[model samples]
Target chain A: MRAEEPRLDAAGALAFKDHLREAVRDAPPRVVLDLGAVDFLDSSGLGAVVAARKFVANGALELAALTPAVARVFRLTRMDSVFTIYPDVPQAIAG
Target chain B: MPRERVRFRADLHAVRDALIQLERGAVLGPLTGESRSVILLVLAEVMNNIAEHAYRGEGGEGSVCLWRKDGAVMARIVDRGLPAPAIPAATDTPNPADLPEGGFGMPLIRVLVRELAQSRRCGCNVMQLCVDDDNAA
Candidate 1:
């Protein structure tokens, strides 16, 4: 999953949710969300990530290449504990 | 002291533009990139909350003010729509893959900002948010 732009706020979040939903529709067991390009994240963006995980059963959603800004959100929310995070896509894919 | 402030309608369409202007204001303030990131996140959550609950699609009913004091970035946002709700207490993000789809705004605001005060005064909802930047001089 590649986030298209820098800021992911309420306006951008809906499209993000739709994108993730499309990925989840016929996704495999392991899913890696590539967030290297996203520079900012809001609650709506975070909710979409969680919602995408819900849409995919068995907790298949994994996060990769979190920028400092994005990483702080998951850390502040303590969401880092919930998902498998990798430093980059290659690491996540290697697993 | 540099001028740092923003004003916008309480419309969903305005949120993105307002945030962009707010970011420009934040860059001129006494904040580092990291501190500005925190401020940006708080603004996104709170401003959208106003659009969803306070304005309820009624544009121009909400306004925001920002300033720097004692190394802390402060914001006071006012809205003439629905009364603001109490920010929820944060707990550990629930595990077990129980991913939530909604209602993550308030939690993010509380965790990111240091001084947050919300109240209803004279039929208007006022929210005061502050995030301290240690590197500010």
Candidate 2:
């Protein structure tokens, strides 16, 4: 259960995408993305989450725990229905 | 009925503060949770676009001018950075699945705001966003 909130920027989006790919490389994975401290999220930021979900699905892993703003983005884009979203880290891990 | 202009850095935190102030000052009538959320989302998207693509993370300042006229809340953002690309014509419905996070900023702005305009003026990019007060109904 590894988590990180790398500094978000235009260029940081690429790094974040790579991080997601790396995180899901191992099998039987459990990952939590903490977005509570993230006050800002751009399209690139949102895309990284989507890409991560795709990676997790490939390995039969679960991805959850989206903060309010991030959850709102997923909802607006209808990705919320696609991803299993939880309010906090514990709930995400437990579920 | 005079317009008010605020200049601040193009950072995300600063833009969030500006959106909060905008809601406090401009939003009249009942402040429903949904309304507040939508306004914040719209403003944040626009500001992020200016900070990321327009300013290219160079830490420049941009101006947001707000004015109420004809029962509408109007905001104009002027930035001395890259010019905005021409917006394609609006389709009937948005395709969320195909939406790329990187390119959705301007499109999201257009969807959330009642009226949106973009142009390049004197080597600066000027974007106008408006929300109709009636939409709250």
Candidate 3:
């Protein structure tokens, strides 16, 4: 799933999560979220991404193509260790 | 010293606009790209908290003022909203195995900033954050 929004901050975190939940209602066991276009992410946005994983049911939720700003948030929170991050969507799907 | 200030309503969308205005203005323009990203991250956490917690009910207005202090970027965020809850001690990120979602905000603010201070002035909540490029990730 691609995040069309340039920013995934507090302004749209909830909506993003809700949208993800709706999109994944009948998803496969593995889901990969494409974050290449999201330039900014705060803790609220980070939480929304983490929360998106929970929406996947028994399957796993992965991430791809973190921008510099978004990468910094994950690194600072050490959330980089938590989520499976990929250089791009294809790489994420390949793994 | 060059200074810039961005003001916005308490809503979350306005918070994003304020960050963009501050990022594009002259104050952060002189900094390195990495330094600016660090500043933006710290300020985004701070402003979003105010929008979500301090002004949750009735909503209000807020402003972020930026200036240089001894080679560090200083940001003063002032909002006419409710007083903030007590700050938690600066702690390491929780065990990721827990799949934590909500507790990363304060810890990110505590880790990325060189200095953090908050107070209630008159009827507003005032937060000060210092972003030192040398120390920030």
Candidate 4:
């Protein structure tokens, strides 16, 4: 799913988690998050991403096309090494 | 640097807006893309840590005083919440096979700022953060 916001704060993060949880409930074996437009991500936002990861099926969650800002959050927290990140949505879909 | 203190609620948007305004008020060369990112990430993590741990998720009112001094952006944040821990140690990253969530706030803040001092005075959490202007990503 593509995020449409410039910043994803606490409230937005929780809402994203809920949406992802619901999506995971009925999603395919693989779920990819398209964070192309999100420019600002905080700890709460990262937490939401992790929560979503835990909720999805094993080896199912993927993140694609992260802007530099969003990518930094994951990298700084060492989460970039944890999540299955893709260069873009197309590759994620293909893989 | 202003002698006057600028205060804002401890909510996410409020803190973020305040930081943006502070950045605009500075006359120095705009922070590099990496520097700006580090500053924002640090502030956001600290603020959320305050909201979650200090205020028990209430996100109570907090105050921020920012000024440019000696080519550094210095800030004193005061929150009417519990005393902050001496240092919120970074937890070990979970194994890839069993990744965990919700433990990156303190670690991120500790890494981004040049200096961080957290203390509890008068039953409040007082934190001082110093970010050098010349710092790069």
Among all candidates shown, the one with the greatest TM-score: 3
* Candidates by DockQ, descending order: 3, 1, 4, 2
Cα lDDT tens digits, model 3, B5-101, are 8888888888888888888888898888788888888888788888888988357899999999998999999998888975665677777778888
Instruction: DockQ each candidate and list the results.
Output: 0.54, 0.26, 0.78, 0.53
- Give per-residue CA lDDT, model 1, range B1-137, as digits (tens): 45455777787668878877877774334467788888878887888888877777666557778887878787888878788787765634444345566655666676667777888999988888788885221
Q: In terms of lDDT, which candidate is strongest?
A: 3
* Per-prediction tally of clashes: 0, 1, 0, 0
Candidate 1 lDDT, tens digit per residue, A1-95?
A: 77768877778777877777887887888888889999988888887788778778687889999999899888867778889999999998998
What is residue A16's positional error in candidate 4, in angstroms?
A: 0.9
Candidate 4 CAPRI classification by DockQ: medium
Candidate 3 lDDT score at position B39: 88
| Steric clash pairs (candidate 1) | none
Single out the weakest 10-residue window by summed lDDT for candidate 4 chain B.
B20-29
DockQ of candidate 3 relative to the true structure: 0.78
Tally clashing residue pairs in candidate 4.
0
lDDT per residue, candidate 2, B72-93, as tens digits?
6677888887886765556232
Ten-residue segment with the worst summed lDDT in candidate 1 chain B? B90-99
Judging by lDDT, tell me the better candidate of 2 and 4. Answer: 4
Clashing pairs in 4: none
**Would candidate 3 be rated incorrect, acceptable, medium or high by CAPRI criteria?**
medium
Instruction: Please provide, for model 4 over B1-137, each residue's C-alpha lDDT reduced to its tens digit, 9 standing for 90 to 100.
Output: 44335576767667777656654555322666656666667777777667667788666888777666786777788898888777654445444345666666777777667888888888888999888766653
Candidate 2 structure quality by residue, lDDT tens digits, A32-62: 6666555445556776766666677442334
